[model samples]
Target chain A: SAVISQKPSRDICQRGTSLTIQCQVDSQVTMMFWYRQQPGQSLTLIATANQGSEATYESGFVIDKFPISRPNLTFSTLTVSNMSPEDSSIYLCSAHLWEADTQYFGPGTRLTVL
Target chain B: EDKVVQSPLSLVVHEGDTVTLNCSYEVTNFRSLLWYKQEKKAPTFLFMLTSSGIEKKSGRLSSILDKKELFSILNITATQTGDSAVYLCAANLYSGAGSYQLTFGKGTKLSVIP
Candidate 1:
């Protein structure tokens, strides 16, 4: 398992503003993923952050709305641009540990747009 | 598209009772199945089952995978109020392109009363 940390545990931001959530892992990892969970809904994959390359986003998510940055193996950031009430959700970051088949997640960022 | 499905969308049980969560998946190049517990925040890693017929145990929680049935089951014995949370099931899809993404199912919400 990986020791992962995320910034801004909870935040209420104004609509049209952007918030960047940071994810830091204590150990190096191969892949980092971003996810979103709407109220009363299941988690939805946002993107896969590949080191030194562009992220691969899932359907219903695009780079223009959620830009990801992975400069190295232990850290990544996700920016929610042009936030809206519909975009209000918990954003989570996860990484797959080499020693385990499971992916460990960081404490999610709870964003509420006003 | 790869998908995962979990049964008993929600369950309410008293403490000391045993609860079982089920997850079934259909994915190409299936790799592994994982279980997580989400309690108000991030989903914490619980167990990961890779091979069939092998059960993974952690304290009062144990999980087993059945590859032939394309499903897995997590059993929590002597459950407590602290065990109340959303139990999530995810499957790792090992794409031949040297990448894998976890497909999650709508979690089963378990509420344990004292």
Candidate 2:
């Protein structure tokens, strides 16, 4: 199991503003991912953060809206650009350990857009 | 596209009662199935099943997968109030590019009343 942490545990932002969430892992990981969980809904993958490369965004999500940066193996950042009330959701970061079948998740960032 | 569906979107039960949650999946290349328990923040990993007919148990929680039937079930015995949470099921798929993704179900929200 990996120890993962996310910054800005909870925040409230005005509409049209952007909030960047930081995820840091205790050790190096092969894969890092971002996920969103809307109220009363399940988790949805936002993108796969590739180290030293562009992140892969899922369908219905655009890079312009959710830009990701993964500079190293243990850290990544996800920015929710031009947020709206509909964009209010809990953002989670997960890291996949090598040779492990499970992915460990961060505590999650709760964002509320007003 | 991979699809994962969970039955009984929400369930309510009294403490000490037993409950079972079901999850079914349809994917091109199934690699594994995972169960998670989500409370207020991030989800906690419960079990990961890759082979069929093998039961994985942890405490009072147990899970089993049926690859041929394309489904899995999680059972909790003598549930407690602290056991109240949303249980999630995810299917991992091998995408052929040496990468994988998880498709998650809507989750079964279990509320254990005292």
Candidate 3:
């Protein structure tokens, strides 16, 4: 299992403002992913953060709205751009070892768009 | 569309009582099923089951999968107040290029009272 951490555990932002959440994993993982959990909703995949390459965005998510960057295997960032009140949710980052089919997630970033 | 469904969206159990959470999925190219416990902002990994009929246990929690039925069950014995949380189940599906997607169910919120 990998130790995952996210910066700015909680934030309150005005609508139209952008916030970038950083995720750091203690060890190198084969895959890194971003997910959104809306209030009373299930976890939805945002994108796959690929090292040295473009992140793969899932359906209903886009690069412009949620830009992700993974410069290395142990670090990644997710930026919510042009946020709206609907963007208020918990953003989580997960690290997958690949050797095991399990994914370990970080303490999520709680965002409140007012 | 691939989907995962959880039963009894919310459950209330008394301490020392046993509880069972169910997860069923209809996914293509299924690879694995994972269980997570969400207390606050983070959803902690609990178990990942790939094979059917094999139970995985940790402490007082145990889980088993039935691939033929496309379902899984997470059982917690002698539940405590600390065990109250939302339990999420996700199904991992194989995508191309060694990539995989995890489809999560709308977690079951469990409350344990003494």
Candidate 4:
């Protein structure tokens, strides 16, 4: 099991503003991912943060809207750019330990775009 | 596209009662199935099942996976008020690029009344 933390536990941003949420893991992980959870909905994977490489984004999500940066094995950041009211959701960061089947999640950053 | 569906979107029960939640998935390159409990923040890992016909137990919570049926079930006995939370089910799919991602279901919101 890995411990993960996210910055800016909750934030209210104006439309068109951008916010970058940071995720820090207690241990080095082989995989890191960004996920979004809208109100009353399940989580959807936004992208997979690859160390020293461009993130692999899921369908319906683009790099221009949600950019990810994974500089190392223990840290990553997801920036929600040009936010809108529809982008108001809970953003979570998860880390998967090597050979582990389970992924541990951060405390989640709740972003409310007004 | 991977899909995960959970039954009885919401459930209400009295303390000490037992309840069961169901999850079914349709995904490619299936790797594993996981259960999580979400309260106010992030979803916490509960169980990870990689093989079928195996029951994983933790305290009063138990889960079983059926690979052939493409579904799983989580059972809670002697439920408590503290058990009120959203129970999520996710299916892990191998991307074949040395990575795996999860597809989540619209969790079952369980409210345990005292």
Candidate 5:
């Protein structure tokens, strides 16, 4: 089990502005993932952020829109660029601990684009 | 494309009642089934089941997986008002090299009314 944390738990930003959300894990993880959840909806995988490599995004998400960075085994950041009101959602980061083979999630960043 | 579906999108039950949530998935190279409870922005892990017929329990929550049936069930016994939230079901797809993709269901909104 790993403890995950995110920065700026909740933020209100203007449309067209970008926001970078940071995620940090307590221990080394083999893989990290980013997810987004819209209101009254379930989570959607944004991308897979593996250390030392480019993030693999899921369909409907792209690097230009949701760029990801994995600098190390325990730290990752996701940037929501050219944000729009439709981009308002809760972004969450998860770390998959190889020892447990389970993915633990961060608190999630709630973004409101006005 | 892989997909996960959850049944009874929303349910309202009285406190002390036992409720069961269902999840059916068709994920390529399925590896595991996971359950999570979301009370706020972040979802807290509840259980992860990798094998069929094996049950994972934690206090009032118990979950079982049926790979043969391609489904899983989460049973909450003696529920409380605190249990009111969205319960998510995710299918973990193994893609080699210890990397996996988690596809989530729409989730079941369980409202435990007092």
Candidate 6:
């Protein structure tokens, strides 16, 4: 099992500001994913982070808004730029070993933009 | 569009009752299906189903996959108040070798009352 950790578990930010959330895994993983969960809604994949490549984002999400960086196999970060009330949500990170076919998640970063 | 749909968006049940959560999906390349339980924080992985006609069980929770039907079901028996939370279903999309992303359903919110 992999233990994932994220920094600043909870934070309240103001509009037009940016917040970068960090994720670290105990073991090396080829891929790391970032997700956003809005209130009363399910999770939506923000992007997939590769160890040394540009993050691949899902439709309706742009790198300029949610830039991601994965400099190594064990760490990645997601930056929410120019935050707004609509961007207030919980951001989570996950990693896994495919042979195990299971993914473990971090506690998540709860961001409330005012 | 590739998507996952879950039924009974919200349910209120009494303790000791049995409940079944449903998830259907439509994707180009479906690699696997997963179940997760989310309380107030991050989602905890429940089960991962890759093949049909196989049942994965753990305590009061169990799940099965039907690839031909493009759907899956999660069963919770002898439910307790502790089981109240949002049950999520996700579909893994296989884009290429060592590449995948998870698309989630809207989720089923279960509330177990006394």
Top of the candidates by DockQ: 4
Q: Which digits, one per residue and each the tens of the lDDT, describe model 3 over residues A34-112?
A: 9999998989999999897899998899999999989888999999999999999999999887767778899999999
Q: lDDT tens digits, residues A1-114, model 1?
A: 789999989899999999999999999988999999999888899999989789999988999999999999999999999998998999999998867766899999999999
TM-score of each candidate?
0.97, 0.98, 0.98, 0.98, 0.98, 0.97
The reply for model 6, stretches above 4 Å from the true place, is none
lDDT of 6 by residue, B1-89 (tens): 89899999999999999999999999988889999999987899999999998999999999999999999999999999999999999
Error of 3 at A25 (Å): 0.6
Instruction: Give the whole-model CA lDDT for all candidates, comma-separated.
Output: 0.92, 0.93, 0.94, 0.94, 0.93, 0.93
Off by over 4 Å in 3: none
- What would the per-residue lDDT of candidate 2 be over residues A19-110, giving only the tens digit for each residue? 99999999988689999999999999999997977888888999999999999999999999999999999999998776677888999999
Error of 4 at B53 (Å): 1.2
Q: What DockQ results for candidate 3?
A: 0.90
What C-alpha lDDT does candidate 5 achieve relative to the native structure? 0.93
Worst 10-residue stretch by lDDT in candidate 1 chain B? B92-101
lDDT of 3 by residue, B40-99 (tens): 989998999999999999999999999999999999999999999999999988877888
Question: Higher TM-score: candidate 1 or 2?
Answer: 2
lDDT per residue for candidate 6 within A8-90, as digits (tens), equals 89999999999999999999999899999998889998999998789999889999999999999999999999999999999
lDDT score for residue A5 of model 3: 97
DockQ score of the complex predicted as candidate 6: 0.86
Q: Report the lDDT of model 2 for residue B86.
A: 95
> Candidate 6 at A53: error in angstroms?
0.7
Per-prediction DockQ: 0.84, 0.84, 0.90, 0.94, 0.89, 0.86
Give the lDDT of residue A32 in candidate 6. 93
Tell me the RMSD of model 3 versus the true structure. Answer: 0.9
Error at B15, model 3, angstroms: 0.7
Residue A75 in model 2: shift from native, Å? Answer: 0.4
Give one digit per residue, the lDDT tens place, for model 1 in B1-114.
888999899999999999999999999888889898999879998888889999999999999999999999999999999999999999988854566788999999999999
Record all residue pairs in model 1 with backbone atoms less than 3 Å apart, i.e. clashing: none
